[model samples]
Target chain A: MENVTKTLDAKGLGCPMPVVRTKKAIEELSAGEILEVVVTDRGSIADIPMWAKNTGHEYLELVEEGDVLKHYVRKGGKTTDKEETPVKTITNEEYLEIADKGPVTLIDVREPDEFAAGHAPGAKNIPLGQIDKRMDEIPEEGDVYIMCRSGGRAGMACDTLETFGRKNLIRVAPGMGDWNGPIE
Target chain B: MKVAIIASNGGLFDAYKVFNIATAAAATDGEVEIFFTFEGLNLIHKEGLKQLPMPEGKEHFAEGFANANVPSIEELVGMSQEMGVKFIACQMTMDVMGLKKEDFADGTEVGGAVTFLGYAKDADITLTF
Candidate 1:
């Protein structure tokens, strides 16, 4: 008989919940052992793999049973880890700080007229409508931060950068107008 | 580098949502853009961005810009350009708002839904603000 793998059901959760639970399960497991995670939240579908990559775990399988998503992951064998890395969640202040530093690209994803009125200091203008045809303008190096009037447009930019293999990407927590900071 | 943002709501909160998305995209090195339509045109109106009440529970901007560090409407529009975020005002909303090209910020442009649709059609991802 095949050995039973530890299963974690994290259905009906949102965003980081499923990923957090899976991380906990992987921590309790031994090397070569499998962890099966069942989740119903759609956000979990994207969060799991990202979590695994960030945590140095190997993702094995993903299966959908009925309405539930089942993911199988393997934990690393090393018990003594040298360094602990911080998770990559963008905050409003952090966004400003990064922008203040050089070698950063900041894009406004709003309409043209809106940009002319007010925006951040040193922010480049590229309405979301033109991003596809103007992909050449994007740089392959350095951190890229996406912003709009709200958080919605930034999410799209984050997903786009991730799809294009631009790993150093983050969405502003709030947005340019909503950010309680200085604007150009 | 393809970025697409959907602006469905018309309130100040909605405008802020789109602003955040564009700024974050720019930080990631992607040529970022935001498509404002329907109620989104309100975002361009100088008055619309200023003196608006903030969303509840948000201590910074919600308490009011005077008390908070939030940039004013004019300031946000200026910073958006500095950050490389392109702002596109919807033509339909412009007509509804009874506004003209001169009514918006310095570098504002007018666009219709077809323009935004064409741009977002093949985007890596499209998010509604």
Candidate 2:
């Protein structure tokens, strides 16, 4: 029964929203403080715990009162930083410089619609979501370049690829949004 | 990460928000599933493209989005599917709404509350739109 330093009313908010709001709320609390969140979304039972685990916070407990759920979370003294991926990154200009120099494996991590809407010519569509299932499609030996709309998804893809023993991967950061190159 | 989205609203804006979040989650390598129930089932129907309309008083906002190059709800659904976001239509809702399997989009799957709850049970994040 830790003292609640703050309370978040996340009732009626859905997935991501509750977690998103909880994250912001937790930031305002001091280390070792507890934050109580009341939510009506049944999904929050799983969401809040997962979010806490991923972010290195302690998920204390949750109590359900009729339709409302009350979650207790203990803030970690220091928020754990995400692990650093070994993948290297390149600028859009740098990618262009090496685009036609030789054979390069460019993996577009954007959704197929976005890829179809416009993408760097000759780029292969291996969206981030399908990466696990499509890992075999990636060549074992090649200059692998991953790009997304911005750099976030590409970074995630790189992290996933790294877990699969991919090394020396290159991330096309600040991706297609800034690309002035030709589109497919 | 396993993410489940429960779409219960029929408004075009709500569907748009759901798809947008679904696609973004998929892009982040999250296992995303969108369950269409109640009025939300209309979003996956074959006729959804023609039937989707902005909620009352929000009709004017649609034009703003169109002018900004935002994709339509249909296109967003396509994007969500392409990004590996699973689309599930509620069987109970279909029965109540008089919708058949053939009435839904090509990739839509049918399931009941139990099925959705199973996914939600293991999901890292669950949302209802």
DockQ scores of the candidates: 0.02, 0.04
True contacts kept of each: 0.00, 0.00
How does chain B of model 2 score on TM-score?
Answer: 0.94
Candidate 1 wrongly placed segments (more than 4 Å): A1-184, B55-61, B64-70
Give a tens-digit lDDT track for model 1, residues B3-80. 888776666667656765565454333466677676666676666656445556675755553542344555555656
Q: Model 2: per-residue lDDT, tens digit, B21-106?
A: 88656644578988899988878877775568787887888667655445667777776776678989998888887889888877
Q: If you assessed candidate 2 against the hidden native complex, which CAPRI class would it receive?
A: incorrect
* Residue-by-residue lDDT tens digits, candidate 2, A29-104: 5445578999887877887887787677899999999999999998875321124555688889999989868768
Docking class of 1: incorrect
Error of 1 at B113 (Å): 1.3
Query: Interface RMSD (Å), each candidate?
Result: 11.5, 8.4
Give Cα distance to truth, residue A149, candidate 1, Å: 37
* Per-residue alpha-carbon lDDT of candidate 1 for residues A4-115, written as tens digits (9 for 90 to 100): 2478977765433465457556755544456788888766567677666656677777788788898877765532111221213476788877767665687777777878
TM-scores for candidates 1 onward, in order? 0.38, 0.44
